[model samples]
Target: MSNELYHKCHEAISQGRAILEDLQQWDFETIIQYPQAEPQSTASHLSTTAMPSTEKTTLAEMESGLKGCSLCSLAKQRKNIVFGAGNPRARVVLVGEAPGREEDEQGIPFIGEAGKLLDKILLAMKLSREEVYICNVLKCHPPGNRDPQPDEISACEPFLKQQLALIKPELIITLGRFAAQELLKTTQPIGKLRGQWHEYEGIPLMPTFHPAYLLRNPSGKRPVWEDMKKVMQRLG
Candidate 1:
């Protein structure tokens, strides 16, 4: 067989293997809940004040306002703009970079394989999706799941800020490098950012590896669990 065909065959086999792996039920027992500790004070001057006022006071209003949004080219090909889901009045808000294939299809955040893993992680922390608000930095999916462009983020960030302003969550958890960097406005690697407590708009923010990363690197589960344990302890 030619080299090109050989590579294609290998790629197909790898994709099939990944599909099979995704289909198998993941073990949740490994996601044990570590004991929570008392929330500690941070010297970092980040405040707990609410975000600046916006026209949209309620999530409903925000969603309605975003209808037919065409601020960026992403809206042109997107099936739906993922407005987000979960408790509108949640104390904790989970933020991701952007929508993926399944998220774009369903117009929901974190509903794919990575989402399933996130559900398990939340369960391990004795939390449910209903207890937290989930959203993304960009409402629309980038073509081929590429990194969000600067213009796209600029167009979409205001809506996200408005969402946070309305929700006024006590704490925020950012998933993955892009989510963390974009919100924090820093270029620090996730390894350096994770396992540390940061602040965003006066709310305590924690950065951790995305569940999709955990799927690819099973060893990352331990550190992500450590991060969640810190979150639980902070909420206590």
Candidate 2:
């Protein structure tokens, strides 16, 4: 594991555990603080002339649509759009939450420490990155790698929908809570939402623990692997 990933996972685990200690004494609303996004980048004006009105029919088309996209506030701060990479006609598509620091730097999704683990999971299923399409719910990395805000999701959702339409994959796998909740349109926690079959735009969808989560909680790897088995069978 990279030092950055290890440290992040460690911190998240520790902080999460600390919160659990006070689970019984929680006052729900105040405990969950929604942060207002400060000006992370100079806001840019979006021209509808550049935006795609009709559905994009190819990866190239989707790329064109995102080339200069500034529909949401994330556009100004992003290094690269992180459009997605893999077979355009892939049988499986995996959606993650948002680009992390490494991902933003590389302009690719799932190329960090968590991404390496995701590769192993794919290998376990007798697959490679070439066989599966990988992307995020949002194209841009959220400032500070925080959860994507509502406006960000709304702006990015159309692109994701376009990708799914073009690829027409047999299955879609959602990596973490954010992707799961966004795609499922639910407020339930990941613990309650994962390990079940869901659907999106007629394609079968599965929600599982993200590799980052597994990195922090090694015990989670087993259940994630179990989910992969089901994925393998479905692919066959």
Candidate 3:
């Protein structure tokens, strides 16, 4: 086979393997409780602090620690932790895949141009950042801001789960495909994931486009608006 065909075959095989792995772990009933297993160390430096105490550490302190975390390989390349910011006790939580260059520099989630668009969307819903919590599936920025690897998600998921447990939000808004897929544990495309309400550990989850994606594909905004309306209706 020619080199180009050989590369295509390799890509296909890799995708197949990923799908198989995703399917094997797609048990909706499995509730991942907190204070669970620790992640294996990566190239990034691990902190000396103990696992965040359920009660002792305030959300701010926990976030501070997370910002300094070096639990995964992304830490080595990241400029900042991109730990989520906003009202810790917010009723709605917005979860994305990971940080990008802008977010990494600011050490905040959803603050870039895409973040600005998100703000507009939230305002359209008559909501503000102070009213809701925003976070990413992975705390650190992935290289080139590419999609997060499965292992990276696995390593970072526990922290997000812990945050959810602590905040105990009424609803979760999964921004974009990665967040929806990881939280919902489905191989279905984002088109199917949207326009529906799913549950995660009893919290209502609404999937929508990532602001960054909407920046590229303006037409996607319509469905995302629909999803936001559902969130508003539920919250209202």
Q: Number of the top candidate by lDDT? A: 1
- Model 2 residue 118 CA deviation (Å) reads 0.4
lDDT (CA) per prediction: 0.86, 0.84, 0.81
Q: Please name the candidate that would achieve the greatest TM-score relative to the true structure.
A: 2
- N/CA/C clash count, model 1: 1
Winner on lDDT (1 vs 2): 1
Off-target runs (Cα >4 Å) in candidate 2 are 1-54
**lDDT (tens digit, per residue) of candidate 1 on 44-89:** 1112212222376689877866766666677678998898999999
Worst 10 residues of 2 by lDDT: 24-33
TM, every model: 0.77, 0.78, 0.76
Lowest summed lDDT over 10 consecutive residues: which window, candidate 3?
Answer: 47-56
What is candidate 3's lDDT per residue for 1-236, written digit by digit as tens? Answer: 99999999999999998876774454222333445456745442343323333232457756654544555567678888876878878999999989989888988898889999999999999989999999999988898888898667867888888888888999999998989999999988888998799999999999888999999999999989988888889988
Model 1: residue 78 alpha-carbon error in angstroms: 0.2
Model 1 misplaced stretches (Cα beyond 4 Å): 1-54
Report the lDDT of model 2 for residue 9: 99
